[model samples]
Target: MKNIIITGTSRGIGFEMVKLFAEAGHNVLALSRNSKPISDLNLKNVSALSFDISDESEIVKLGGYLQTAMKKVDILINNAGYLVSKSFSELSSQEFKECYIVNVLGPATLMRTVLPFMKKDGHVVNISSMGGVQGSVKFPGLSAYSSSKGAILTLTELLAEEYKESGPSFNALAIGSVQTEMLEEAFPGLKAPLLPIEMAEYIMDFSLTGNKFYNGKILQVSSTTP
Candidate 1:
């Protein structure tokens, strides 16, 4: 079984992923701002932590924990994301910062912190948004959220190239709308075609095998736009 680390596990896709991976006999480290949701599951193969990805100290702590506990990581899924839907003219600088911190900076930092614990066959899966893909349909209120995701797409490619010869492969998934709490909060009344569990299953499978077929590539997984 592989040792997998998944972020944003308090709810939605992350939550489902934790269950799926553990049920499949993998060791899972579930991280989120609120750990109770996963903690209550009581899965033997799963360990949950209240992690704030935007905090540098927390990231450092995570690195230490992996060094001592896991020793090596097989899969790292950067799934946590932040979004704020507001008119461009009314968007605050702080709002933009918050978006980038959670969506871009946090995941980028996480990859760096986890790199030392990964092997050549390891995989780093970055969860992105369809809105971030250039030429894809764009929405007005997501300037900050979409742009931050776009940054992750480029960062994935650059990192993959930088470490091509040494080891772990990096790739991104530009996903579409899903029926999630974050979706309801950001765009009320809009129904998404996909469910969180469905997406999580795809990611779980990819995290295990995608590295063999692709690297530094952004796979657009969407049938609808936000």
Candidate 2:
């Protein structure tokens, strides 16, 4: 089985993903802002660590911890992000910076630090939002969140091309809205078209097989209903 590292694993999709990988017998390293949920799992194949992804010092600590056991990481899922719903004029520069750090910089820093441990033909799956894509339906309150995800999409392509010779692929999944706490925070009255577990299953399959057919792509996950 592959060695997989997933960020934002305290709850929602990331939490489900760790269970998916662990149950399948892969070596899973799960990172989160709080470790209680993952710690409670008690899965033999899973190791949970807690750290705020937006903090550089914390990221460094995570890197150092991984250096000991991960000679080769088969997959890295940059799944942690922060979100705040507010109109552009109401949003502060600090809010944008915070969103950018968690959504973009955290992944970039973690990806760079983990590069050496990535095995050949391994994959990096960046979690994004459909709202990040250029042609997506614009939501006024999601400007900061969508923009941060857009930036990650760009990074995915750049990294994939830059590491072409190394054989490890990078791709971004601009996921459709899933029924998670994040979505509830974004749209309180609406029901999502997908659930976290379903998205986790899709992500797992794509991480294992999509790199061969599609690398450096921003695959949008959405439904016809909107």
The residue-by-residue lDDT of candidate 2 on 78-197, one tens digit each, is 999899999999999999999999999999999988888886689999999887898878788888998999999999999989998886899999988899998897789778878999
Clashes of each: 0, 0
Q: Once model 2 is optimally superposed onto the true structure by TM-score, how far is the C-alpha of residue 178 displaced, in angstroms?
A: 0.6
- Tens digit per residue, CA lDDT, model 1, 60-137: 999989988899999999999999999999999999999999999999999999999998999999999998999998
TM-score of each model, in listed order: 0.98, 0.97
Lowest-sum lDDT 10-residue window in model 1: 217-226
Give the best candidate by TM-score: 1
lDDT of 1: 0.95
